[model samples]
Target: MVVGGSLGGLAAAHELRAAGADVAVHERSAPRTPAHGAGIVVRPDIEALLHRLGVPVEAVAVELYESRRLDVDGRAVREEAPQWMTAWDVLHRVLREPLADVCHRLDGALRRVRVEGHEVTAEFSDGYTAHGNFLVGADGIGSATRRLLDPSFRPAYAGYVGWRGLEPESRLPGDLRELLSGRLTHFTSDGMQMLCSLVPGPGGELEKGARRVNWVWYVNVAERDLPALLPGRSARRSASFLPPGDVPPETAERVVREAEASLPPALAELVRLSDPFAQPVLDVPPWRMVADHAALIGDAAGTVRPHTSVAASKAFGDAAGLATALLGWTPAQPLPAVALEHWEVLRLDRLVTLAGTGRELAAASGLGVGAGRTFFTGD
Candidate 1:
């Protein structure tokens, strides 16, 4: 069983089913329309999962032909390979296509989990109990599974926050469209890093005029300002992020003002006209990932800072790794714990490296590994 119905949990459910395992996803959150959760840089791990599920993903993403860092003269420092950009909403849909035969129950929040003999049992908030040979914690950064497994682990928050915005491609001034729409652009100043690229519009509208420009500005925020800054739009402090529309008009304006003062003209204008939100940059340590017969996947395993841009891909990697191990193990040699162990061994190394790199980039305030090279050598 997978807890949390977002990208991680759903991908875990999909991968396990593909490996011929009977899977069920239990979500605590109420079922609702998937909002454009956040913009993501599409990587091969995500593409491979989509291909395996036969989910058509071409229409769900905006193709970016280049990536470059800007110099003081406003010229590109260097250009790199093309990449695809899309929203979490689109990828979530892609992962969910194959779950029709799998049990995906919403509002089934897990209240307690324990291992009895060789079986793992999960008690849900709705008072439902389920037993399985193995359980996976694909929850999220605020993962209940992680806490239950190792209460000693806590996510570390950086001294900075990522301010985000999404604007219609057509809404951008015509002169800036060509520079920003088909490419991922970056600017660094005063130790702050800002990036902008295009992504498919809501519902995956790929037309030229229908696409959206996505930007993330990493800025330093003092501890004293956090309470006011975070609650500007959302009334409560997020363990991770405050989604759009919760940001107050005045606070969004201040963010725009900062962007104008700090970012390049094109990105600054994008922030000025777009609806905005913010999420704290968090650092988390490497998890054991596996405890007894249960495994932690996605953000549950480790919260890689956003600088890696693999938050979703990392979850897919974990799910895919676990699924592969389960698929290759023969019944005669079947040891659920051994398979989980192997997967955990491989995932821990990866997650630790990612967390370190994320910290480095966040430490640099967003300029490190901005080109997707340091984070990924191959899928």
Candidate 2:
């Protein structure tokens, strides 16, 4: 059984099935792509896993021929940093389409897990129970499975937040679009970094006029101001993230004011023309990733800062590793404890290394270690 049917959970189920395990994925919400999403730069690990799953990345992705650093006036110094980019929705669709009817049980929100000897069971809030020989927790950062294993788990907010948005290509000002096309652009200033690149539009439309420009601006924000920035109707719901349209009007206005003051002209215009959202950058160097018959994968195991560009790759690698460990274990068989233990030992070390790399990158950029004014408690 797999808990939390996001990218990690879904990938785990797919890989495990290929390894000859009968898997059931339990997701709390309806299976749908997030409306407020960001761009993804395809990395090697994820590219390999997608190919293994027979997905043609080129068909769903856009290519950026160069990486350019821009001045506040929109002047550029270009380099040959070629990359393939895709929208989060497009990739999610590709991964999800193949599992249309295989093993998804939507609305099955996991509430508890019970382990009796070699058997593992998942209990859902909806009063449902599922039994399996082994359980994988691919649930995201706020994983209930991880919490069950270690109640002290908390994601330390890296004193900043990313303001992200998507602006339609057709709507961009003529000169701005001409300058940004076919390039990934970035600008850096005191306590802030912003980047913009072209990505496939809604429905994976990559044509010239149908694409979208995705941008992310990272700014240092004091912890005390979080409640004001994240004013959701329900405090708990918007503590960590505010999806697209949910960003409060005043917060959005403040973002525009800040953008005009800090960003390059073209980049600020992109922010002005888009409906922006905010998500606190967070990290947690996981102390433990496995316990008996259950193991956490993806963000559940370790929350790494996105500066490493390995967020998705690490999750996919975890899925591949877990599946490989269960390669010879067939359906209705006893749990492969020894194989799991070996995988856990290796996985723990790798998770630590990855988390450390993220921290190093964040610190060099002046944003990772003790970056925030206060630790986020999700109050």
Candidate 3:
């Protein structure tokens, strides 16, 4: 049984079914793509999963040739190696389409997980219950299963938020039209940093004029100011993210002004014209990933900063590793803790390294400078 029906849970179910095991996924929220999302830098691990699942590389993916660091005037300081990047929406659709025929329980929240002897039973908010040999938690960073297992686990703030934007190629000013196409560009100065790259347009359009240029800017947000930066109906949801128009106009304008004052001309223009969105950069620790017959995977396992470009890859790795461990283990068989323990040991190391690298880079004085590549290079 799998809890959460996002990419992580879907991938887990996919891998398990491929390994000849019956799987069922339960999701708390509606099974639909979120309106607010960001871009992801795809790595080989995710590519391998796609190939393994026979999911073709559709036009939804955009190739990046070089990452160019620019000066205040948009002049190149240096160029670094490139990689492929895609939108969260595109990958979600690709992963979900194949599972259309899979056993999915949408809009069902897991209220309780009861372990009796060797069997684990999951009770949902919809009055439905499921019995399985093992449970996989793919419910994201705020996973209920993770909370039930380890109450002390909480995401540590990185002292800043990753301010992101998705602007269309067509809407761009004529002067900056060729600035970010076919390349990942960035600007860094004083303590401010920003990066830009092309991602597939809406519905994964690959055409030059139809694509979207994605950018992210990191800025300090003191703990006291977080409540103001994040505006919800109630202050309790400050930890949650806020989309463009929902953010306070004053705060949004201040962010745009900061971008204009700190970033290069091209990036500043992109930010000025973008629909702003903000997500706090967080660090997650190595929690008890496996408790008896239950396992925590995906963001539920670790929420690393996005600098490493391993967010989705880690999810794929978790799914692949868990599937391999349960290769022929059936739901009717006795659940073994040895394989789950081994899987957690292997997963924690990678998660710790990725989180460490992201925090270090984020704290570096010259984060976007030096053409330095320290994380997830397959190195």
Candidate 4:
């Protein structure tokens, strides 16, 4: 059974079914249409996973060139690396086709796990229970499975928040338009950093009123300030919960005004035009990726900072690896701790290195000088 029916869970279920196993996915959210972020950068590992899952890589738009531009006070530096930017919804749509046969139980929030000698059962908040040979937690960062298994593990705030939004390419001012029209661009100075990129839309190319430019700007703030910045209402209910719209009107106005005062002109203009949204940055220390018959994948397993642009790839890797291990499972040896341990051993080193690299690069970007390409290049 796969707990959490997002990309990781869906991928895991698809892989298991291909290997001739019956799979079921339990998700907490309502059965609404799939929605995701503006775009995602696909790496080699993610590409390989998609290929292995019988997904035609060519069906999805792939950005093949390596274009990296970093600017500080208008002076720029450039480098090359293998990268592809594709809309998140496009990737999800491609993956969803193969998972049609899999049983997806929506509105089934995992409340607790019951692990007996050789079998595991999951109890959901909606009074449903599922029995399976094993349980895989792809439940994201605030995973109930993780809490039940290891309550000691908690996500630590990363000392900053990422404010992100998307705007049409045509709406940008002339100077801002020229700076961010093509190529992935970044501007960094004095504890502030901004990234803007032209990413393909659902329609593929920008013909007239079609394409969008995505933006993510990072700024450091005290942890105490987050409550005031977050939307005053509960985050669990709203599907697209964001700080500006959810907070009191007066507070929201003040936050926008403050952002305009502190951010650069191009970034400030984007914010002025954008319906602002905020995501609190957080990182998890490495954990034993497996415990008993259950294993954590994706954000639930652990998350590194986004500076490395490896979170999605790492989650894809986890799903692929776990599927491979489960293929050899037999009735006599229902769950093999050793096999899971091997997977954990392989991932731990990479996670540690990535966390350190992200922290260092974030610190450097905060200091005004642009960071070196080591983090992005994986060197």
What is the TM-score of candidate 3?
A: 0.90
Better of 2 and 4 by lDDT: 2
What lDDT would each prediction earn against the true structure? 0.76, 0.79, 0.76, 0.69
Residue 207 in model 4: shift from native, Å? 5.4
Evaluated at residue 13, the lDDT of candidate 1 is: 85
CA lDDT of 283 in candidate 1? Answer: 64
Clashing residue pairs, candidate 3? none
All-Cα superposition RMSD per candidate: 5.6, 3.0, 5.4, 5.5
lDDT of 4: 0.69
* Model 4 C-alpha lDDT per residue in residues 43-76, reported as the tens digit of each score: 7766886788765555465443445455433555
- Where model 2 places Cα greater than 4 Å from the true spot, the runs are 31-33, 233-237, 331-334, 369-379
- Candidate 1, 277: how far from true, in Å? 0.7
Worst 10 residues of 3 by lDDT: 370-379
List TM-score per model, in order: 0.89, 0.92, 0.90, 0.85
Model 3 alpha-carbon drift over 4 Å, by segment = 233-238, 366-379
Model 1 CA lDDT for position 245: 87
Candidate 2, position 220, lDDT:
78
Candidate 1 lDDT tens digits, 1-379: 7787898788788787778888888887778734544788778888887787675567678888878787645767667658888897777776777677777888766778888666788998888998887788887777888888887878776667778877788887887788886788998765578888888887789998888888887776654567777784436777677778888887787787777766777667778888888877766677688777778888888888887898889998999998887785443554666667787888898888888887776666433323211210111
Candidate with better TM-score, 2 vs 4: 2
